[model samples]
Target chain A: MPHLDILKAAASSNQWMAIYPELLLGSLALVLLALEIILPKKQHAVIPSVAIIGQIGVLIWLAFNFHTVFLKPEHAYTFSGLLHHSEVGQFMRVFFLLASILVCVLGTIALAKQKMPRIEFFHIVLVVSAAMMLLAQSNNFILLFVALETVTVGFYILVSYFRTNPLSLEAGLKYLIMGALSSGLLLFGIVLLYGVAGNPTLPGSSANPMDFTALHTFLLANPNNFLASIGIVLVLSGVAFKIGAVPFQIWIPDVYQGAPTPVTAFLAVASKAAGFSLLLILTQNVFTPYEKLTTPVLAIMAAATILFGNLAALTQHNVKRLIGLSGVSHAGYLLIGVVAAGSQPLAIGAIYFYLFAYLLASFAVFGVMTHVAGGDDADQDLAHYSDLAKTHPFLGAVLAIGLGSLAGIPPLAGFMGKLLIFVAAFKAGLHVLLVVAIVGVVISIYYYFGWIKAAFFETWRAPLLEGETDLRPMCTPVGIMAGVALAMLALATVVLGCYQGAFGDWLLALKF
Target chain B: MADLIFYIFAAFTAGSALAVVLTKNTVAAALALLLCLVGVAGIFVLLDAFLLAALMVFVYAGAVVALFLFIVMLLDVQGGVRKPFKKATIVSSVFAFILLLLGLASFAHKGVQTTGDLGAAAPVGATLKSYGEQLFTTYLLPVQIVGFLLLIAMLGVIVLSKKFEGLEDIK
Candidate 1:
């Protein structure tokens, strides 16, 4: 009777504020859509500006209300446990907003160069960013599935935004098929888990079992249930597909190579962040009871992903494809955080820190790619980057720092992130994974440095065009804006690496 | 009598679903899909989910099947020709078989059940009302988010299909 009463009370209570950030972004998307219809095509530049402004506004709102989420424990479960408002969710919301702002800037630069519909591109980015924010707060299977699908479907359009490019279309088709298949697998897994949790024969089972806490209780009660194990593996496989882990990462290189550079950047950072957040949530909350069953699977996948991603990137000639392969290896490193999650308190913190560091470095590199490869898909070849320093010293420096961060070089955020992850794994006694990760890092340095060396040491040999005098002006307003964004990100990377102690402590203090 | 009706609908469902894949003519395949949807609706009625049955017939059979027919007719694809089966067919069939086995193994136990206490004893009318209540109250956020999803899809279709001013020369 008391349980029923509590359920009724929770259901009736209005906690709309828990979803305020999502609501703001969703409304902004609609507003942008309306403006797109009403405004003249000549005035389309305002759309990206408006999108960027809205994203910044959301970040400020998040900052103002951050304490409500972090300090108050009673506001955690809103919409009857559908959304969990916690410090981790708050942090991720800010992280996604930051990423969206950078992407909006990159998208604007890309849009100005290409002759595409500006409204749809910007508005869809807003919608997808909102979905990712909601994704970080989803505490139930229904919300998780819906939010994940929203992000995936939005990315499908963004990936193939260049409708005229056959390569982009091909990448879109591949992504759609694989995405649909993974969604089916994820849904099937949720159904199986729900069945086991809601089984009346099981003692202390709930009538409504999609909630994570309820599922956690059921899992703990029946830790060795055959059906649950299958469900866990299936769900993990779907997650692996999202994060571009080994076995399910076949689509990464093609999609990254074909997608618009800004979209590729979004996928590399924000989409991966969403996947890692969900994986962390699942491991810490629902799969803890079955840790004995799940950790080894994750460890093996992590090692294999690191090996495959790095080894394959050794031969890739395309810059985007190299980054794509390297992204797969980063997923492997993130998976180490997932494997050590059960035993190490700082594991999730390490994952988030690595993601933040990855975001800055990734966007900086992708931003340069966006400007450098303007209006030409053929310009992404690595050979084109020869003597970039001689032609564009500023961008050359940005690319070097970005690549260095990705390679986990010292005095950069990437190195600090990797150090935290390695320390966590070593503490958890994941010796084999730690060794494999170190080797993966070593292999990664070879390819990263290749790009750096090309930019710095190789000679520029391409003939100048009729109108181009000094390899084109790199000081236009758009160029200046992009340069400022990259410079800020590079500065943040160095600052975060130096201040890792304080940042990591703050992240680790948050309870899931 | 109910059992007899269930068997009839189930057989129709299986047969038409198979026909949907086996038949080469696109229009005929669309018609077969329509029949399969109707058969599934009939089965839903047998399970006493009257609301779901109506939705199945109206949405899937009426709207989606109509859309499929329109697309098939518009494309004017030449069909009824047997094409050589490729390696993809073999790979897909193997995966399909493995999925079938996994599904069967997961649901084979007598103790396995899909419905909980709330679904066990409800009459059709009461269940429908409660479903509405749940949808409006507990599931409101997902419902609204789905609205945004549809909006994004609409914008995507327009963006992909429309011919902008300067894009025609780029290809």
Candidate 2:
């Protein structure tokens, strides 16, 4: 060993200690995989619980101890600058772990719908969850892109989990083409950004932070540069594609319509939340100057996204398509926070709060969809939901709460999430955007209620003169999901509105 | 001087990529893409990262593209006969051309970092040694991860394609 290098090793115990959460989760993933194969098939279900425990423990560990890591952002010791060990990273790490557990339970419950195997599904969920966790907290662009791909490749498999279902295949194709396009755009933009960074006459501070802190400083130091602006747009486009934002959201409806209900819920909620987390970290760290320059572009996209999501949703009779469009509209709302960025912390905070609300609500709503329409997860028509409330009051009630929350109705968590976002937007001097956001919120109520009415008001009518069909049978497991839904809605009532600080701290601690 | 060479090779890569996309025949497209891959390698070489360029060719062209061609031929997805340019294609191509021009114009003004580290360019052996060291010391976990992924994929494919004793073969 070089004599001076020995001193470098002796100097950095804290650096090794910084990323203990990621290390623990990673080791736990391997242990879970091994345990899955070793454990008896009957009790293999316990594996996910074990994984969740490991994940939650990391969060608890971080919440108690990671503030010091956050304070010492410069103390990362990794493959050059590949992994950033920070409190913000530790915080976002929790999302990946928690979301994975949610997905595993939801997916395992949903597997009963199609009678698919659980072990592989659970294994893949954990793997995909690990990838999402890795991607969200990534500081380097190369690592970020790779992590996104890792999550998505697993997603492709999950989308097509129902092999015999033609609709599932269709959804898979749409996701693939659109995902590839977004990735191509992302790669091209990365190459260009590399070019811009390559030509510096002076050596950079701290060996190219490839992470957000360095990237943000670089972009901000030279504000007028078009490459930085264009790069930011390209990166945002990649994320928008993931979250199903407009212009990039053309693939969403088809995927939602075709995929298993649990998969759609996963896509719309947790996966989309991961995209929000990525955007949050990136905007906060990498494109701090993007506020001054790219505000107009974001404003236009946000306005269009809200308008398009609403107008398209109103015409859709398919419950899946409606929910899909609903997800897109919410993305438009989240973009308001993205637009506000570092200039308004509360706006970004609102985006994070809204993600939690949206995820829980979507899961509950899709849970009801799985319950009532026990077909091939393809029958998402309002007609399918016509007689739901009559037979299954609990499911209907859960559906109502989900739809109401999604529509931003007061006293529900979604409404509080939106109100906080509105306040944030106002702080950012986005009056026009705020008014449009409110209008978007109001218009959403009409569409969301339209479905609720169908769920609640199910009077039998004489068969249509032209054609007739039999409604599918509702399944028993779906009833179980409805129970999960009721629990989530009840939790949202007080958990989000009253104790806003609980989620607010978790979301805001995301800033690097 | 190196930048000029890099630009030349990069244009070659860009042109080759365009040719790959434009080709009507699948075989021709694959061939054009091969050229594009090689040109990208050359661009890497010109960037003073000779080892990376060599690795690009060795891994990308030698393994990935060869696998791609094999799968392309296996699938028999005909590129179909050439037709007159559709309005959408024209709009897309025009948009692409405009983007290219804008990119070039902006790139000319950008500050690029160039290194005069030509002598440091390692051969296949030395390059392998360094790459191995880097992967092991720095990216050991991610590297190990890629290996596990390969193992899983192999097991999955075996499961998918293998036959059973009692089940009637569908084919």
Report per-candidate TM-score of chain A alone. Answer: 0.94, 0.87
Q: Model 1 lDDT vs. the true structure?
A: 0.85
> Pick by lDDT: which candidate is best?
1
lDDT (tens digit, per residue) of candidate 2 on A1-512: 67446445433432444456655655776687688578765676577567656666766776677566445645653545566655545555665665665666566556665545444555556666666766665777767776677677767767777766888878887887888899988877776566565434423422343555566666666676666667778888888899888788899889988877777877888788888888777767677666775677767888888888988898898888888988898989988888876577667667777877776677667767766656467776787777678777777777887887788887778888888788888888999988888888878888899898887885576776666666446545444533654566556654675676655776754555
Question: What ranges in model 1 sit over 4 Å off?
Answer: A1-12, A38-41, A69-71, A460-478, B1-15, B80-126, B166-171
Candidate 2, which segments miss by more than 4 Å at Cα? A1-81, A84-91, A202-206, A463-469, A477-486, A498-512, B1-12, B76-79, B82-96, B99-103, B106-126, B141-171
Query: For model 1, which pairs clash?
Result: none
List model 1 lDDT by residue over A1-512, tens digit each.
87576457656654777778878988898889888679866675677788888888889988888878523777678887888877888899999989888988988887766677777788898899999998998889999999999999999999999877787888888899999999998988898888788777776577678899899989988877878888898998898899999899999999988888889999999999999999989988888999988898999999999999999999998899999999999999999988987899888788888999999999988877776774565248776677678878888888888999999999899998999889989999999999999999999999999999887896656788788675432322436667789999988888887776776789866557
lDDT of 1 at A70: 26
Reference-based TM-score, model 2: 0.86
The per-residue C-alpha lDDT of model 1 at residue A25 equals 86
DockQ of all candidate complexes: 0.38, 0.24
